[model samples]
Target: MSRIVLITGGQRSGKSEQAEALALSLSAHPVYMATAHVWDDEFRKRVEKHQQRRGAQWTNIEEERWLSRHDMTGRVVLVDCITLWLTNFLTDGQTTEQILQDAKDEFDRLTAQDATFIFVTNEIGSGGVSENALQRRFTDLQGWMNQYVASRADEVILMVSGIAVKIK
Candidate 1:
């Protein structure tokens, strides 16, 4: 069976780096699914930095909000992070159920493809409770999304201080 790995950690926890490393170990070329939108100069610069780090070997695919079910196909596909993607979906006014359904569809598509998959996500639930309702909802959804993905993944890793701890 093809392996599906989920890497989750706090921001700047090197989850992306670790995901890339794991993708590199795969026998196939890595396809990077970048979900970040370059909305401003700072974000563009950050994206550039990430691109530079990944280098020219990776086949970069820009997938903003709600990746279509047909998008994930290659020898290995690494979704850089899912936090921004979730936020984009939420801000776009997608209902919670719709968001969950879309995510499930995308996950199914990835699993059905003949390729290894590495999903990177942020561990957003460990932070203190949010004061605002929207923030709280986002936090809850993020936790739920992570749980759903990890449940389906073959390997789940939590990164802390650049160290990976296998959770499942």
Candidate 2:
């Protein structure tokens, strides 16, 4: 059986740090599966900073989408975000419903493997409604995806100002 853990919070709330720690506690050489797409130089620098933090003990996999393609069997895989992963799908110009369904199916397939998964995600809908149409759409998509993942997670942690609050 696979163990699924979800760590979610607002921006800069330390969700990734907590997820990495949990992954390290579970396995010495946990896989750091980053879903970010480096759209510019600044973002590339941010990705590099993350790589530097993990040290040489971690195995990093950069997969923007199609997460199930990678065989993560018998390994602890920490996906450092769902937001960016979903954004990749969004940019493909798929309908909202289609994207959501695809994400859910991909998640189901990935979780079918016998591995421990620590997912890091942002709780972007926790604030006031966004005025931008695109932002609002993304927020809705994010919330639905978060709910789906949380429902299947064995444990859920919400990071607030560097504090981990168990919400499973």
**Could you give candidate 1's per-residue lDDT for residues 1-168 as a string of tens digits?**
567899999988889899999888884468888888677998899888888898667888888754545445556888877788777777668777787777777767667776788999998889899899988888888888888889889999999999999999
In candidate 1, stretches whose alpha carbon ends up further than 4 angstroms from where it belongs are: 66-74
lDDT of 2 at 166: 100
The clash count for each model shown is 0, 0
Candidate of highest TM-score: 2
Among all windows of 10 consecutive residues in model 2, the one with the lowest summed lDDT is 88-97
Worst 10 residues of 1 by lDDT: 65-74
Predicted model with the maximum lDDT: 2
**Taking the tens digit of each residue's C-alpha lDDT, what string does model 2 give over 1-168?**
999999999999999999999999999999999999999999999898888899888998999998999999999999989999999998788888999999999999999999999999999999999999999999999999999999999999999999999989
lDDT of 1 at 145: 86
Clashing pairs in 2: none
